[model samples]
Target chain A: MKLAYAIPAAGIAALTSAYASAETITIATVNNNDMVIMQELSDRFEEEHPDIELDWVVLEENVLRQRVTNDIATEGGQFDVMTIGTYEAPMWGERGWLEPLDDLPEDYQVDDLIKPVRDGLSHDGVLQALPFYAESSMMYYRTDLFEEHGIEMPDQPTWSEVRDWAEQLHDPDNDLAGICLRGKPGWGENMAFVSTLVNTFGGRWFDEDWNPELNSEEWQTAIEFYVELLGEYGPPGASSNGFNENQALFSSGKCAMWVDATSAAGRIYNPDESSVADDLGFAPAPVAETPKGSHWLWSWALAIPATSESKEAAKTFITWATSQEYVELVGEEEGWTSVPPGTRESTYANEKYQEAAPFADFVLNAIREADPTDSTLEPNPYLGVQFVGIPEFQSIGTQVGQQIAAALTGDRSVEDALNAVQRSVERDMERAGYLD
Target chain B: MSAVQTKRPWVGVLAWVIALIIFFPILWMVLTGFKTEADAIASPSLFFTPTLESYVEVQGRADYPKHAFNSITISLASTLLALLIAIPSAYAMAFLPTKRTKATLLWMLSTKMLPPVGVLMPIYLLSRDLGLLDTRTGLTIVYTMMNLPIVVWMLYTFFKDLPRDILEAGRMDGANTFQEVTLLLLPLSMPGIASTGLLSIILSWNEAFWSLNLTASKAAPLTAYIASFSSPEGLFWAKLSAASTMAIAPILIFGWMTQKQMVRGLTFGAVK
Candidate 1:
């Protein structure tokens, strides 16, 4: 009787201690494809590690940015793990909002990550986040359309050549647009495309002195060229179409060409998702006067917030989700096509992935060729491929994006829009103490 | 009158045309819900291959039932709480007016004019301190506060529209003050209360800004769920349309079921 009672008491104590030690980590992330895959595959991780539980806060990109920024900046302690990106990791890491992940377990192969992506996601010399998916911009076009129309696209086309091709293939009566590009009015929308255009046009967002250069002749020319090309051949309501809209357009066989994130290739080539999956061809992103900044680089990364009470558990989750084992698991379960790509070199080396992904060469080449440290044709005092790295870029870029959209819609002249952008950016720079 | 009557057929045709034009956007959205993203945004006229991929993607991406539960709880709780508070307050102002009653009511109404964003920072800090950032209780409170002025205003108008004779007659019959108001005033003003409550529910259900800003994961409602379908890269029109359809389905069904009550409450004792 005494032994039985002691055994039950000991069992109860163990249960109580287990309950007390249980940690629930809240992860805030954008609703991206890779993150969604991670969320779906997390049950296996949970089964293996019963001590930790995951709570997700999946939001749109802008909302996620706002939520994580506010929480981490204010030390609100709302989220344990945050899904950040190339744009945010270095900035946030420098601000101490993220915990350095340099001490990842040996099997994690911290060195195997693509160097440019790892460098972009690191602060000083410390890796702040592990990449989930990284990408550079590339061109996705309809091979069937090209063949049917007897048009040939070069491996590396110039902007003038692309312009001619767009004009040739544009058939408004047939309901097929020549090109699809992001024109929606947000910093990450039209401005993302426009920034690259500005780069290849031999224009920079700012001079060495941090002076606003929206009204520069090169920028003006680029803006005019963009408005003319999109206005003549782009689809109706193009001003409202962003990356997803453009993707839908391109995938539905409505667009002859699209230049955007290489990550989109997976979805565009997936037969289950896209109608033009088999009819697609890839090329380097089109360039203008300079090929220096023809494409932009980006990575979506998993990070542990400083506000997390369950930092260890959160780190464990991130490590597992972004680990090489997880990539292999995704491949075996969902097929090699669905494995998150561009984060690890070993993934590209895998024969199954290479064979499964037809657009593999374009994606890898784009990722390797993009140089974030030196993206502009003209000298600049900033470090971003598609965006200017400043606290004020969100507001500044948005204002300029609206102007560009307006210009495209014929609501304003390109000159007027550029002038407005110049004035507003100047004022912002002055306020930010960059215009001394 | 004779000339107008002669053109009545044309007028009727014109009326229907106007009505259809007005309803086209909603119809388009509904039609797009059944379309693949490509077909939905495609320029050519209606004939195309329609697919249910968007709906599947939207539903598969989210826990729709949980978001629906939050929507129901917050909207219903806020509506009920607002009604409970507004009834007595509106009654006191309508039947027993003080010198400051008009000023108080106007002042309360004016609070709605202050942009919610202006007060967001302070409220956010307060919510963080109170540990109410993403709880249903917090959402309910905020929703109640947001819809309170409109609720009180509607209730006040309905109460004022009622005749004082009913309450006086009840008092003369030896009923107590609580009984007189509850038994006499409430029953007679049922239409107004019903309409006001229904309107409050609609307002609370559709509110997105506060819910989006204040809540992150736990207390997120259908509006937040719908927003999650939006991608940073580009608009997945089919997915967006599908997400929108699912989000609005509950409210649409609710509105259909409660049409008669809504209409009755909307006009609520206005003529009499």
Candidate 2:
């Protein structure tokens, strides 16, 4: 009787303790394809650790950013996990708003992360967020179209060469355009591609002492080149086509070339998702004066705010979600074509992934070659290749972007738009106390 | 009367044109919900083989019933609470006037002018302090506060339009103040009250800012559900349309079923 009572008592204590310690951690994320996959595969995480329950707040990008920024700034403790991007991770981490994630377990092999990706989310040489998916801008072309046109594509093309090729490939009568580039005006929309264009043209957003450089020769040349190229050969209403619109255009065989993020490669490579998947060809983004910052680097990373009460659980979840084993799980379950790309070397080394994604090595190289710290040909104060990496950059970049759109639309002259951009950017800098 | 008859047929055709123009976007959404992702971004066309894939996927991915429940309960509960508070206040303001009445009314309406973002931090902190963050009770309270001004203004107008003689006669018949107001004022202005309540419910149901900011997983309404279907980096038009269709179905159905009373109540004071 004593033995049986003791056994039952111990069992009850263990069960009750387990139930009592169960922590419900709320994870706030943006509604991206990779995030959706993570949410779907999180059941595996639950099975591994039954002592934690997950609550998700999947929102659109801007809403999620505002919501998380509000919560973090106020220390409201609403979300334990936040899905932030490279742009925010360093900015937030520098302010000590996020917990440093430098001490992940040995099995995680944090060194396996692509260096640029790892550095992109770090501040003060300490990791603050773990990358879930990363991308570098690249050029994708239609091999079939090139072959039919008897054009020999180069491994590394210059802007002049591209313009010449676009002249040959331009076929508006056949409903095929020469190229498609992001045109919608926003910091991350047209400005992302445009910044890379400016970088390769040896232009920088600011010089030393944070002086605005929109009046520079490089800026004028790059913007003029872009406007003329797209105006002559881009699709009708090219001003409204962002990444998705361009992808749809490319997928439907309406565009012969697209220069955009490498993340689209997976979708474009899938025969089910793209009609021209088999005929797709890719190369590094074109160069003009310099190759430094020829491509932009971006990543969507998972991080924990300092206000989280359940930091340990949030860390565990983020680590697992970005783990190599998780990559394998995604490959087996959701197919290798659907796996989150550009984060892990182990992913590239995986035979199945390599077999599934032919451009895996090329994408990995593009992501690795991107150096955010030393991106421009000239010395600059900011950290990003495509952006200035300040809170004020969003407003400034979008304003410049809108001005560029006005130039394209003939509402303003190129010189007039550049002058407006120069003045507004200087005003912004002065208000930001960056200039006297 | 002869002129009115001549204009009637032309007015009917014009009304249909206006209605269809207004309804076209929602109809487009409904049609897009049944298309494949490829078909959705192809071009706007009506003739495509309808598919249930997007609807099936959206419902399978999200907790539709729970979000619907939160939307219904929050909207109805908030409307009821607003009515409970506003009806008496409006009655007092309508039947009994004061020197600062106009100023008070203006001050109440001014709260609506300040953007919701201005108060986000304070309310978020307050919600945290009250331990009501992400709770339905918290959302209900915030939404009640959201719709109170309009509810009060609408009810005040409604009550002011009523002749004060009915309540005075009820009082003369030996009925108490509470009884006179409830028995006389509420019933006689039933259409106005019904319309105000319905409008309040619709406003609360359609509210996105407070609903998103105040609630997370547990009490997130259909706005959040619909928000989850959109992605800045991916193609999700078909899925987004499906989620939107389901999100608005409840209110749309409610409006359709009560169109008769809604039409009457909405047009109650227009002619007068």
Candidate 3:
């Protein structure tokens, strides 16, 4: 009887002490380098709080999206903090699935966040997420090859000029593609690039009434031009190439020029990871007939789910991760270029960052100039530069990615591909109650 | 040299070619793991300076032994549980004729055909309700249920192949049902049972979907580990290959060591 009482007393004491000592919050994030750095330096956050613990679940972008979506929808409380993008923050926050991050401490410098990055993470003027790193698309080319061929790259090049340059640089005889672009069939994979191309060509996915306008004249011209350019001058099997594949090709000196996320600047400039690090040059993403949406903005941000039981603790961690102090810590600990970019104006203003990253000013301007709400040349209803800011956009854009691939592979004509996309997207919009 | 002897060398060459075709991807992955990130994407070279950069970085970022330990324990625990439940059911279906036995077996096999995503929500909710999410016990239970149908069918076939005379003799000698199954049927069908257990272990070890969805950090297996190395921002092929190499190394070695038993057991039911 005495032994049994002792066991019960010990169990009660252990449970109470464990419950009071620490509040562990789980964070689900992607495997990008910036997020990895956040995970690495979380120990600092733990040290500061002392009563909080951090657990991480790092997955690829698509996997993490699905996992976090399921958990938040079900109110499973599996993850306290979720690393999302501009694509998710607004839509989910509109549904009240995310906790509004209001009243952050003054030192957090909520005002220092770049406008586009901050606005993209808010729904109706309420900040719903804190950005970790933001990126905009741009053109990366081989300066050596440009000099050798006597080609002049414009400050803000147009598609026609880019086409002529691609033709001039075409050298299949020596295993070089004039240009490489994302051609993989996924919403975030190729659609991200293709949507910006459509925007610069003065195309919009929908009108103000939310009717899909995929078959507009501007879209046809853009798709036809895209098909002709990539089919004639792009790498063989371009349909299988995504951002990573294109990066690999360019860094290995197989592609004369490429266009992709500004975040890739660090990797492609790192001498250890890239062979063309010494010969690289960047330019604003090429425009086509209009320069309105030549570049697209995207960011990986952290937000607390409404289902989180430990909201206060989760807020503490996210605030620390997105603050200037955290940025300085990363700059000092992992070198200056490794600091998360495009989120804070201060990071771009830092001389240390400018000394390390030559493209800092250009990337900052690109991010600032990419206004998601007003990106299209013609007026449109969407709130994203490269995507329609509706949840249904994911499925709709994915199908369009495949349709574009079909055009590039010669399985469908440009007109035919756009027509198919137009019809399917109409059906989706109708079913989603947007058409009514 | 007779005809058989003359054909032996050619057959050996054909076998080698077929094996090489099947093994080429794994071989490429292992080789790429040792290359630098820059060299990895360069046009394939038969020879390059090997480095431990990727392996070192992967280990620094991820805790491999923790995931490996989870994989080992979950696979073994799930396999043992699946076998324990499968054997008696197989014995009952093979020995005692029931009207619904065939239907029951067919129905169990049909469960495997169901798309995992169809029931993912309910299963996740159930696991969460039971406080089993992200626990090794939860994963082990899921793996056991997933492998049960196949394990039962294999053992049933093996038991059917066994001569019923020995079991009848033991029964006549006053051995009870439990005694007869434990002492007689088990010893007789050891090869089939061993193969079923091994196959279950391999399947559970390489399982990705449920493991990824259910476990977050603590109980995640090597699938999650490999996934963390695949960056969306830029190329990290060498590190990804290193993680892939590490994930498959244990299973590859286990399969190789147990090749004889698996080959014998798989071929047993095929012939007299």
Model 1 per-residue lDDT tens digits across residues B155-221: 9999998889989998999998889878998999998898899889889989988898788767888
**Candidate with the greatest lDDT versus the true structure:** 3
Estimate the TM-score of every prediction: 0.88, 0.94, 0.93
**Chain A vs native chain A, TM-score per candidate:** 0.94, 0.94, 0.95
Tell me the deviation in Å of residue A71 in model 1: 2.6
lDDT at residue A47 of model 2 (Cα atoms):
91
lDDT digits (tens) for residues A359-434 of candidate 3: 9988999999999989997788878898889989889999999999999899989899999999999999999999
Candidate 3 residue-wise lDDT, B164-184, digit = tens: 999999999999999999899
Residue range A237-301, candidate 1, lDDT tens digits: 89999888888788777898898888898888987668899898999999989998788888889
Model 1, residue B77: C-alpha shift (Å): 2.2
Q: State which candidate, 2 or 3, has the greater TM-score.
A: 2
RMSD per candidate (Å) reads 6.9, 6.5, 5.0
Query: Candidate 1's error at B114, in angstroms?
Result: 3.7
What are the interface RMSDs of all the models? 10.5, 10.4, 8.2
Residues B120-148, candidate 2, lDDT per residue (tens digit)?
A: 88999999899988888999999999999
Q: Which stretches in model 1 have alpha-carbon errors above 4 Å?
A: A1-22, A144-153, B1-61, B170-179, B232-260
* Model 1 Cα shift for residue B139 (angstroms): 0.8
